[model samples]
Target: MTTNEETIVMTPLWLAIEENLLALEGQNITEENKEKTVQKLVGELDGKGYAVSKSGIKMMALRWALEDMLKVGRPMLKDLTKALSELTLEDLANPCHASYRVTDNLGKTWERVQKTDRRDALIQMFEEAKLDLLVQKAKGLDGDLGIRLLIEETVESPVILERMGIPQEKLDQVHADIAAEIAARNKVLSLLETVEGKPDHEKVKFLFSNDIPEDLIIEVAQIAQADIDKAKKAMEEELKEQQRLAEEAAAKKKAEAEGPALEDIPMDQMAEHIYAIREIQYFSDVEKEIRTMCEQSAIPKAIVDLSFSDPDKFDELEKQCEG
Candidate 1:
C-alpha cells in the first residue's frame, strides 16, 4: 500500500559508514592508507549513484562516528551480498520484504542438467553482473542483437560463474549444452548462406531443427526444386555455349584451310566438318530458347527435363513446354 515516496528513504551516511566500517573492522589495516581508502570508498559510492551530501561525506570520513553507530543497520544490504553469493532457485521466490527467507544452493533436478546448468549458471552470472544492467542492455538492443549479446556473454564469462557453486556434474552439463547450441547455430547460418535472398522461416527451421510448419515446409521444398531446375538450365546453356564456340573455331579453321584441294579432300573429313557446323547451329538455337525459359522461372522443371534428355533438341522441347 506504500507509494514510492513513502517507501523510498534516503540512505543515511551513518548507515553507509557503519556497514563499511564493520566489513573493514575485521581487516588488519595500516594507518598510512586510511585516508586514501576513505576517498576511494566515497568515489565508488558516488559513481554508484549514492548522493554525497556534506554530512554523508563527513560521516564517511570519521571512523569513530562510524564505530559509535548501532550495528543493527540495514540487514537488506547484507542480505543482498549473501543473495548474490549463494543465489539459488529458492531465494528467487522471495520478494523484497522483512519476513522473506533466502534459499541455499540445491542439487540438479533434470536429466539434461548440462544444458540446464549453462542457462542456470548464466542466470547467476547475470544476477552477479546486475540484472538491471542486463535489462537495460536488452532494452537498448533490438531483439536479435539483445539475444546475440546475451548468448555471447553467457558463453564467455568465467568469473561470475566461480561464485555460482555449481557441482562438477552440472559444469559438465553446461559444456555439452553450449556445444550443442553452437552446432545448431552454425547449421542455421549455413542454411541461410545457401539461400540467395532473405531467408524464410521454413529454411531457417529446417536447417536448425526438425520443427517446421507444413506451409513453410512445402515452400522450402518448392524453392529447392526450383534451384535444381535453375542448375539444370545453367548447365544446358553452358553446354550450348561450348558447342557454339567449338563450331565458330572450326569454321574459322576451315575458312583458313587450303581444303587439301577439294578433289583430294577425304570423304570422312568432309562429313566431320559438316557435322560440326550442324551441331554448332543446333546448340545456338537451343541456347536462345533456354535463356528465354530462364526469364520465366529460374528452374523451369519441364524445360530442364527436356534440356537434360535431348540438349540438341532443347529449342523444340522448350517450345513444346511453353505451348
Candidate 2:
C-alpha cells in the first residue's frame, strides 16, 4: 500500500466514533442508534479498503468512548474521593447543608446534592464512580481488549456480547436467559396493564418510574398492535392536556359551589353554616388556609384547637385525605 493508503487503512475506529458522537449531539444512547453506527463504521472502513469486522470496529469505538469518559472523569473522581474521605460519618448520616461542590473538565464547579431519603451521596456520584473504575482498569489495554474488559467486569448483559460480536459459549443457555428475561418483562407489563387497569399512558409512566427499559415498552406496544407514536403522544401531550383541562374544570366547579362570599353572609348565618365543616369528606392540604379560616372564625374553634392540642390526630386526618 502507498503511504497515504496505509495511513487511511490503519486509521482507528475512534474517527468514526467521533463523527457519530458529533451527529448525536449528546443524545441518549439507544440500541438502534448503536447498531446504525456499527453499520456506518463497516461501510466507512470498506470504502477505505480496510477489511475490519463490524463487531471489532464497534469494540474499538466503545473503547474510545470509555477512554474519553475515563480521562474527563479522572479529576472529578479524585475530587469526589478526597471529599468522601474527609466526610465524617454524621455528614453521611444526615447532611444539614443543601449541597456540596465538585469541579468538572472545564474547571467549572457544580454542587453535588443528596435529597432527603430519595438520593444518597454515593448515588449522586455514580457517573464519576463508574468511569473512574472502568477507565482505570482499561487504561493499560488496547481498544478492543479494553472494551472486552468493560463487558466482562460490568453488570451489562448479553446484549453487549451481541454488540461486540463476542461469541456466546453456551449459546442455548444465552437463549434461555433471553427468553426468561422477556417473559419476566411481559409479566410486569401484564400486571401493570390488566391488574391495575392502567391505560398505555399510565403504563408507560409506571415503566419509566421503575426504570424499565424503553425497548420493552416499544415491544409491548408492538405485541398488542398498539401505535407506539400514539401511545407516546398520549403520554407526553394528550394526557397532559387532559389533566390540565380536568384541573381547570375542577377549579371552576369549586368556585361555583362556594356559593356567596363570606363577606356577604350575616354573622349568625355564617356561624350556622360553619357546622358544615364537620361533614368535610376528608382533610385538606390547604393547611395555612384552613388554619387562618378556623382561627379567625369562632365557630370552627374546635378544629383550630385540635391542630394545637392533638397535632398528630390532625396530621392523621391530613394523611387520610391524600389522593
Candidate 3:
C-alpha cells in the first residue's frame, strides 16, 4: 500500500487508541490494576480491528505519559529514567525492557528497556519543544535594552543559545555588534554631559566635532538649550530681587537723614505744634513759626491756609486745653 493510503487507514486507529489512553491519565495504576487496564485497552483496540497486544498497549501508554511530561519545560533526564524504572509495567514487561537506552541533550545515554526508534523520537520531541520555548521568549523581547539583556544572558549561559542551534561564529559577530552599539551610545551620553550649559550653537558644534550622529546631536542640543533657558530665567529673577532690595535700602537711608515729613508725623503731634506756635508773643513771630512748622511738618494745605488766615483759632484751642 502507498504511504498516503497507509496514513489514511492508520490515522483513525491511532486516534481511537489515543482517546482510550487519555482516559487512563491521572489514574492510580498499581500492579493489580495495570494488567487489567492494559487488557482492557488491548480488547478495545482488538474490537476496533487493530488487534494490539497488552504489552504494546502498556508501552504506548508510557510513551504518551512521557511526551506529556516533556511538553513544557526542561525535565531532568534522571528523574524521567527513575520514574520509568518505577512504573508497574516495568515489573510486568518482558526482559527486553533492559535494552532501552535514553540519550540526553549532553550526549550522555542511559541504558534502560525501550525500543531504540521510540526513545530517539521522544528525545527529538523534547528538543523541539525546548527550541520552540526559546523562540517564544526571543519574540517577546525588543529594543536596545532587551538586546542588552539578551546579550548578557547569552554571555553568562552560552549553552542556552548553543542548544538553540546557534553557531560560535554567529555568536561572536552578535557580540561585536552589541559592543559597537554600546560604545556609540556611551560616547553620545558623555558628550551630552560635557556640553551642558553651553550655547546652542557651541553645543551643536561640539557634538559635530566629536562626529556624533545628526539625530543624537539635535537631541542633545535641545537639552542643552533648555538648561540655558532655565538658568537665564533664574538669574533674571535674582537680579530683580537685588534691585528691589537696593532701592528699599536707599529710601530708608534718605528717610533717616531728613527725618519724618509732616505727612508722616501723626495728626495729634501736628495739633500740639500748632498750639505751641500760637503762644509766640509777636504776630510776626507767630506767622514765622507757623510757616516754619508747616514747612517741616508737611501738614495739609488747608491747615496751613487756616493758620495764616485765623491765627487766634489755635489760641482759643490752647485756652480750652488749659481750662
Candidate with maximal lDDT: 3
TM-score of each: 0.23, 0.24, 0.27
User: Per-model C-alpha lDDT, please?
Assistant: 0.45, 0.50, 0.53
> Which candidate order results from sorting by lDDT in descending order?
3, 2, 1
Lowest lDDT block of 10, candidate 3: 104-113
Candidate 1 vs 2: which has more lDDT: 2
Instruction: Write down the worst ten-residue block by lDDT for model 2.
Output: 109-118
Candidate 3 lDDT over 234-323, as tens digits, reads 657878999999999999875664445545655576566555455433344566765666556544444455566776864564455465
**Candidate 2 segments whose C-alpha is farther than 4 A from its true place:** 1-180, 188-213, 220-226, 249-259, 262-323
lDDT of 2 by residue, 1-323 (tens): 47855633343444434443445444444555656655665566566655546366566644455344334533233444566555443343323231233223223431222223323434444433444455455556764555555555553545445544456664345556656777868766665665366566566666656666667767664424254455566667867898999999998875554445545655555445444344331455466766555444443444445555687875665444441
By TM-score, is 1 or 3 better?
A: 3
